[model samples]
Target: MTATIVVPTLGRPSLGRLLEALGPGLAKHRFELLIVDDRPGDRPPLALPPGIEATVLDGPARGPAAARNTGWRAARHEWIAFLDDDVLPDPDWADRLADDLAEAGEHVGGVQGVLRVPLPADRRPTDWERVTAGLADGAWITADMAYRRAALARCGGFDERLPRAFREDAELAFRVRREGWSLRRGRRRVTHPVRPEGRWVSVRTQRGNADDALLRHLYGPRWRQRLEIPPGRRHRHVAITAALVTAGAAALVAASGRRGWTAVAAGAGLAWAAGTAEFAAARIAPGPRDPSEVATMVATSAVIPPVATVHWLRGWLRRRAAEPLGSQPAGLPPAHRCPAGWAALSRPTASRSVPTRPFASRSAEGSR
Candidate 1:
């Protein structure tokens, strides 16, 4: 089977390492390579190996979803395999990928590659490292996923409106299954290493709450249930944010000499403190808990709730009247309808089952 490898990049230094890691696959496989650059303006040329050819296209810089759409749409083969620029594919990736494609039944529209994240052996991982490691148990993440060209075209590719890598892949998977195509877990494996980032990375990640809100708009409030995604901390964030807002409001009222406002302010302030402390402890508990890590956790824990709640509200208000991308499929249910050829795909064999551990769905911006 012929394939095209599509990688969306932001011109990070990891791009070079990723290309080098693909050498073994390129040497043995006949698939084409397409690199979609999501950066703007003049960029340095990529160093290529001898006897290898690749196509580099300019991306819209919208996000990984848009960039991936650009890559697969321009692909020359029936199968388009997506890989993050930071992941290292196993040396036998090409062979395993080919086997996987060959094994895909006629009704199978997509295949997900297994992801393995390497964490520190001697010490507990930091919060960012733990977040990055979530890809290992994530289902249908574009970190290492492939789709048949026909399936992608039928689903209209990814929802570019997502504006980020978050949830877009899983959303597409649902749409594909809703269209009567089955998705399978492939044997190919990729290693996702944790990339270093600033101390405030957790605060930055709270922005995904906005994407979650948009998803809720598109798929309805039960989107998480329909998509089989576990619940997030959105509820807690909302409550914490409410406490903070109440504290500030009541404090202002007390400063204005309102008699009962002082009690309200004190109560709200204590609630906020308690919520923040719990959040910080939860994060710091499983971590290495060094002085710096603890301090970062405490600071970001205090800041994340309000930021997340703001993003969530902004997303909801922005897409308040937006319609779903399309009509829902009519049958047993939208996402659970198994067509003729999907019985086996739905209940994967023991060897094929995706990992059962809880995982965070994320992107390069925050380790998705």
Candidate 2:
């Protein structure tokens, strides 16, 4: 089965690195390449590897979900294999991609490639690295996954409304599964290197709290359970943040000089400080014990919860306003579209089983 390679890029220099490793083998495997540039109007050109036939297209700066929609919709082959630009494919990736779909039954609609993140073995990993490692265990993440063009078309491609990298894949997976097809896991290993990034990146990812709300809107409150995600501590974070804010406000009021307020402020300050220390210590305990690390953790832990809560609230409001009066609750197919008719509206239960095969077994004969 011939497949097309689609990578959505922001003109990252690492895109060149991925191609340097993946390009040479493309010719032998007869795979096609499409890179959707997500930069806004008038970006510079992408200089790809020589001797490779690649199509580079510009997208409406929406985000990875929209960019991917543009790429796969333009694919020439039936199978659209998506790899994030940050990931480096194995030398055998191209051939294995072909093998992934070579024998996919008609009932199977997608194949996920195994992702390996090589963390620092000699030292304790940073928080970001620990989080990145979790991608390998996700059910249908697009980090290194391929979907049949037909399956995508059936779902009207990805919901461009998602407009972000987070949960968009799961959103699509939900709809595709509802269409009565299976999504599988394949053993085509690709390394996702943890790029050096600012410490605040972990904090910045709190924006996904907003994305989680979007998932809840689309898939209902039980979305996390459907996806098998362990319950998050976001609610606890929210509570702690509320206490800290209340304590700070009390301290401010006490500065106006009431003795009773002074005692309350002192108690509140101690509670806030204790909570912050606990949060910071949990983060610090996982990694280096240096002062710089400790200070950074202390500062970020204080803000992450508030930031996450604000975003979640924003998403919640947005979803509530956008949804119509009488639609199916969240992730199920709409009444008109579902084969079960109005019955599907009762949150059609998910059948999560899918086949898994290691593409490594089939591609060994054809790979470098």
- The candidate that wins on TM-score is 1
Model 2 poorest 10 in a row by lDDT: 359-368
Clashing pairs in 1: 362-368, 363-368
- TM-score each candidate: 0.87, 0.83
What are the Cα lDDT values of the candidates?
0.80, 0.73
CA shift at 104, candidate 1, in angstroms?
0.5
TM-score of 1: 0.87
Error of 1 at 138 (Å): 0.1
Candidate 1 lDDT for residue 36: 79
Scored by lDDT, model 1 comes in at 0.80
